[model samples]
Target: MGMNYFHQLLCRSSRWERASATQIVPWALKGLDLGDNALEVGPGYGANVATLRTRVPALTGLEIDPALAARLRTRKFDQLRVIEGDATAMPLPDTEFSSVVSFTMLHHVPTPALQDDLFAEAFRVLRPGGVFAGSDGLDRPTFRLIHLGDTCVPVPPATMTARLTRAGFTDVEVHSAATYFRFRARRPA
Candidate 1:
């Protein structure tokens, strides 16, 4: 199975386990303020939601695959609501959330237009002054060897900032380390 398929399998498992401390959602969420009524796109194995909801009381996840959404619903995470939908064309209303986030999913979105659409949707859903933060694997040999879901577009931090700017997000910032890229963007109040 592909890396994406493996992630789906992990979601189906009863107990969630991450591959590393770095990959754990709690560590990723540290020092970040994910506002209330948050939306997480492609939540992968629902691990991030498990941690994110601790900080944001009303957290929802939009997963493209219905099966994954079903599995997540069964998990019964207290602050989590799972919906089956695509990020590029989200099903929710505009300005509905205080925050929007994604984890390790942008690179797999296929085309640049789709990527922009995903960001646009994120922007549309977020209230002014809200934030978006995520960790994505960069397109590099080591990352490719381990995580085939790494972006085909090689989203450098600058490129992500530019994209966020075009999507009406301001104060975009990126922090790169090892094989991953972390970014935070804010909607203007």
Candidate 2:
């Protein structure tokens, strides 16, 4: 994951944290049951950890950056475990989590192929009938500007259903606004 210094600062900002807690997480997870075990992919700076940990009995964060993962571990988020690993190839066992979520992080995966692999990995870790949900911003000028010198292959909402379906997901639901998109899908029971 490539994070420019400016982007890193923005992610750690209070405004971003507040929006993640009050708006982003809730909007992506509306009407979704996170079940007893939930995994959050790419939880940079752990901005959403506080809110996500509350929704699920056990919440694990899978971060690719070792420093960020260590940072999260030190924060001592109750009911949260920080794991340093790539989402495309998580080290956890199969059929582990009941739900998988990634928020505003897909574009950082560098390529659509890896992003699709992450989707498949989420399916691999989820038990039968498990849900995979999250939100990502649509490609826009401001989004690209913040990601200058970083990996930013934005996932276009129109292509989401096809991609998730290719990863063996069912009940795929994609909702998009002018700037961002939210999605939900289920692994077949």
Q: Candidate 2: deviation at residue 140, Å? A: 0.6
Per-prediction TM-score, please? 0.84, 0.97
Error of 1 at 135 (Å): 1.1
Per-residue error for 74 in candidate 2, Å, reads 0.5
Superposing every Cα of model 1 onto the true structure, what RMSD results? 3.1
Task: Give the alpha carbon lDDT tens digit for every residue of 100-124 in model 2.
Answer: 9999999999888999999999999
The per-prediction CA RMSD against the true structure, in angstroms, equals 3.1, 0.9
Query: What lDDT score goes with residue 108 in model 2?
Result: 94
Record all residue pairs in model 1 with backbone atoms less than 3 Å apart, i.e. clashing.
Answer: none
Lowest-lDDT window of 10 residues in candidate 1? 16-25
